[model samples]
Target: MAAKQYKAIGEEAWKNNVEKVNAELFIFTYGSLVVQLVKDFEDYGAVNKQLDKMGYNIGVRLIDDILARTGIDKCADFHTTAEVVAKVGFRVFLNIAPAIANWSADAKEFSLILEDNPLNDFCELPPKAVQEGLWYSNVLCGVIRGALEMMQMQTEVWFVHDVLRGDDVSEIRVKLVKILDEEVPVGDE
Candidate 1:
């Protein structure tokens, strides 16, 4: 139903409606999801949690769009999948401002610098503190992370730029830093 409408519009049309669609999408989500999901929301905690949850929700739904756009129903390997995500998925679908960097060979993680993040204007924070806010709309990170995980690539996504501190025209950075496995210590020090 709704998915059909979205698909019918095509990516070209969607890009054209970036401003209008994004604005309307914000309004629709604000009115429906934010207001309805969070009860008695007053502080940053409630807002932040809600936004992250909202991103999770959107991530679930966005899987459909990702499939439609990429025609990738499945991945043969994580490396191939991450390449697809970095090259096609993020670049084409979301129209991210900054160029992304892929440092992971195993395809377990990747990173990017996001310029002119869309969610920063609605909320502001220092570059170091951007992820600390409750009202921050970081659902896109969660969306990509969750969506890719389901697609068989366990990944973590996050932002590096905080656009609220007059950091407008800044880069939106996401990292896929590797997780070091804990090694067993030798018997004697």
Candidate 2:
């Protein structure tokens, strides 16, 4: 099955990579950063947008690392790309593989169902944050958007469900806007 292959590949890639960090420390640091953002902005929407922007920046850099580590060549289609993102990408980086589901009729959109979200581990939104409709994992949406963009795939990513907000399942929706044509540099052209 694809899942088994993905797991094996992910595990191998993870082991080969020497650099590592403690999960607890990483999660806690991210949590602290989120709290600070909330305090500074005092508006949940603004904070969410800021977090997305930050994640977008991170994603742009991360895709290069991912390509180098995974050695996966350009994906031929969105379906293959989705599999790579869900199976290899998330598994390698987060140690959790979200399920790809809810493909649209045209296959231009899909949902990622995260059964386990590390960012939410030991995270509980304060009453104010919840009241203000803060999405604790907004950064994830941004990351996906940014990473896809670098791959010449324009997409809109957003969280549709959050367990922190009392949703039964955490889900992120990704809609493909368009695939960009590869551009040659001035001299290369």
Best by lDDT: 2
TM-score of each: 0.57, 0.93
- lDDT of each residue in 1-189, candidate 2, tens digit only: 365766676777777873778999999999999989988998999999999999899889888888898787888889888887888778778888899999999999999999989999999887778878899999999888888889999999999999998888899999999999989889996
Clash counts for all predictions: 9, 0
lDDT string, candidate 1, 111-166, tens digits: 54556554443443435434445434456667666666555444556544445544
Overlapping backbone residue pairs in candidate 2 total 0
Runs of candidate 2 exceeding 4 Å displacement: 1-4, 185-189
Give me the overall lDDT of model 1: 0.52
Error of 1 at 7 (Å): 18
TM-score of 1: 0.57
Q: After superposition, how far is residue 181 of candidate 1 from its true place, in Å?
A: 20
RMSD of 1: 10.4
